[model samples]
Target: MKRFWMAVTLLLTAGVLGACSNLGFNDSSESTASSGTKTATYQTTGTVDSGMYQGVIKNGRYQTSKTRGLATSTNTQSGTYNIKSMENGLLDLAKKQFSTSKYVFQEGQLITEATAENWLGRKSKDNANGLNPASNGKLDEDTRAPIYLQTLLEQDFMTQSGSKLQLGGIAIALGMNEYDYYQKVKYGATYTTHISDAKLVSEGESMAAEIVARLRRLSGVGKNVPILVTLYKNAGSDALVGGTFFRSVLSTSGSDLGKWSTIDQQNETLPTVNNAKPLDSNVSTDFSDFSEQIENFFPTLAGVTAQAHYQDGSLAGLNISINTQFYSETEIMSFTQYVATTAQKYLPDGAKIEITIASTAGTQALITREAGAKGFYTHVFGSY
Candidate 1:
């Protein structure tokens, strides 16, 4: 596990250094094999350039999923943040259990787009294998059954065997809707029906069991492969942040799922507003102090905000954005230095921190501090 994190840190550091040197961050960097065999390389999905990394094999030409574009088409989430969160969040969780050193990552190849659409659609005479409950001819929230399953995501993990790679494990994420939005008729006003947390989890677990059974019946996926299934409750369209994964189950053998585990993860915007849940006092105080220090230095700045991620009730990462009006290259560099210093002073010690300095024109600088690292990496954009 330590080695896995170290590799990630090195990759991130290399990416930042490469970006600073005028080379594109996502540019391919490959390692050659002494035996003249193809080796793994870092790759990113072309669909979303969000900086999430995947390991590719065979000269970096890993097989692309047949249903490549289905995620955007089938996803019902209205917010782009939620869509990205659902996909990337699953990968983050899977990394904890499936170390990158041993297992290579690949996009899902078994489930086709048609199968995904059918599973997401309402069960009817035509689509008997649909996972969602059949809809009745009613629009009222009281009588109509809310659609529980919003979208399905799958990620495959491969293991190397002397120049060959085979499927070793699979991770699947189910994105469930917290509120069901529907219209009574065409061109009619849409109404939302809230689904309780208890109901969502109950439905998600049942769907997961059936999904495992179906996966076992697939051609490539057999009964013995280990599978991890996670359930995520998506936030509403108006939410400031994405939703969280509440529960997950692992199946190592057979079609049955193993004992479920709770994922105590949450995301909160810093400088709490609207009487949000109280954060850890130390973290909250540190962020408050950090914000104050920045504001004191540059009072004319538009605003300072942060999105903090928590895992198992502890701060895991923070992404801070600083909006300023200054554009001079030297001024931006000085401000970046000061911000990095203030962040080192006031930010929590164990969490990874990233600070982005931006102006009305565009992004001016970026500063990143790895978890438990002593120094920060600062880069001012343009010819600085």
Candidate 2:
């Protein structure tokens, strides 16, 4: 057990340093604060992707989000996958509009943790600013109003001016629930009320507009800061895959939102379990072939699965998981090598690919190939 953890630590250190170098970022470099003082740039500890920005330090200290830890607080109501997708997906979408070359990322500092909690709760005499509709004294799903808005996430983008960083833009993602699950009485039977697509979109846009206006009124936030708001529809509590953003709006200037644009993104489990039809037949077949090759190579493997992401009917990324029973270092390395080779051969072209090989104990190896890259980076735990 100790050896396994030791291997993981070394792998993580190498991966982080390598990723920083690849992104052309000096994580150790110092930057001048707005107060005319110098401090180390605050580099984030982890990333969803190696290509993601590690974030720029503001002031002398790392400014933690005013609404930190809220994601987990609502993770029960919103599935864990949905929570992750809402945060990471927003960053991916924001990069399209806010280029990484021009802007340095920062956590949302404008919204306080308390304010976020209030807004996510049901409106009442004490909390009138709540985004969720006021609760009437009804228990039935039909009569009771559903909580449309689940959580709000804010991401700040900054532009470097000399050694100091200034707020260049902001991206806010609102996570809306597809179904409102609640217990009629405390610890009693739980009931769910389905929220239609039309209603979710309509309510999301209205909430976004209000959020924009409120943001403009904040002290540090001026009327000119470009704000991008996106609405994410969360998957059901029992869903294996997370939901995707349906609509987005960009306010380049002033408080009023511009036209909303449709985002055609989706998440699907590969191999089409339960006789479900594949969304993309070609990709599914390729994955099936890849799995078959791996299993045939090592018949003792427990199982193989993958989660495929798509944008506009095109493959965007693939995350594959391989469960193995082998623990020997040499065997793991051999399997990893074969998996990487087979992945390049069978996976669709022009999409990011990541694969993890794990045993009953823990992760044994990792392989990744960036989109458009011809080769893969393979790392087997304890191999070194």
Candidate 3:
């Protein structure tokens, strides 16, 4: 037993001397306020086909309250894949840059030798007119091409991680997001791809090793303790762009990757209250932007709050409550349509949206039972 302890100590000493610096496990570490956690930033440069991307990964440690004499530490990682280049002609550039067979450019947006045949497959005159290269406004191939690239890169990243790591629970899925500007590809001559705030939570052996090592080095309390990893994007940028949560165990799951669990930050029950006032800061982060947009639409808006309900990490439905002075039936209808369309973009397909409006007189309700493609109001019903 004495010899065994000595050998174990020697091995750990060697490991500390060998890789401590590379792991950034130095003594002088930055703390995350009250939590006894540390933060580390990781960067990787890689090429997808010919297009190069700079991947940024940020990690942080967290510990929730102890339960059954076990305190678990949660570690999170959030990432972004960015591409920049001086390229023109979106479709041509995509074909030259990416390794994909199906680079299908929607008709009426891009013109080619096959444009006539593609146009012939349309269903109606309006559809045909909509595809006219001259009539389609700026919805051309140059702009839409980057969207395809973004989608491809995002999927590849997820697949790569899935194959490499053993994650726990449900893996957090990335959302399809469109920025107001695409740097160069859309409105200008240059082309760039920016995919932001895809999150991965670590649960399993990967997280277990980290906690055990840290505990062994510090005070030796981590044996078999649960660890959480909450990867938050846009931590320093726009609040709305990137704050998806993927809760995974930090320890290894006796496998390559930790088990991951997807969480809807906005999925929660509303606190019971008597007043019909505006919701407080307790509003879920998911609905933060929607609340702000509504307030801006009506400066004198009384109160606004939104809650999202989820099942198995999938958005099941949405509930929004708003209090304002007064608006006509037409105005209310337009507002409901607008909200339904906007929320649908960020929500899963087939998810429902329920909107409740409270005016000075009474209350009204609206429901989009079937939010359409692009979140259009396909089936809307309203009642006072």
Those runs of model 2 whose alpha carbons end farther than 4 Å from true positions after fitting are 1-50, 58-61
- Model 2 has an lDDT value of 0.74
> Quick one: ranking by TM-score, best first?
2, 1, 3
Clashes of 1: 0
Better model by lDDT: candidate 1 vs candidate 2: 2
Candidates 1 and 3 compared by TM-score, better number: 1
lDDT of each: 0.71, 0.74, 0.31
Better of 1 and 2 by TM-score: 2
Candidate 1 lDDT, 244-323, residue by residue in tens: 89999999988879999988888888878876765787888899889988876655855788888888999989989999
Candidate 1: TM-score?
A: 0.82
Ranking by lDDT: 2, 1, 3
Candidate 2 per-residue C-alpha lDDT over 17-44 given as tens digits, one digit per residue, 9 for 90 to 100: 1122122223332222212223454343
lDDT of 1: 0.71
Report clash pairs, candidate 2: none
TM-score, each model? 0.82, 0.84, 0.25
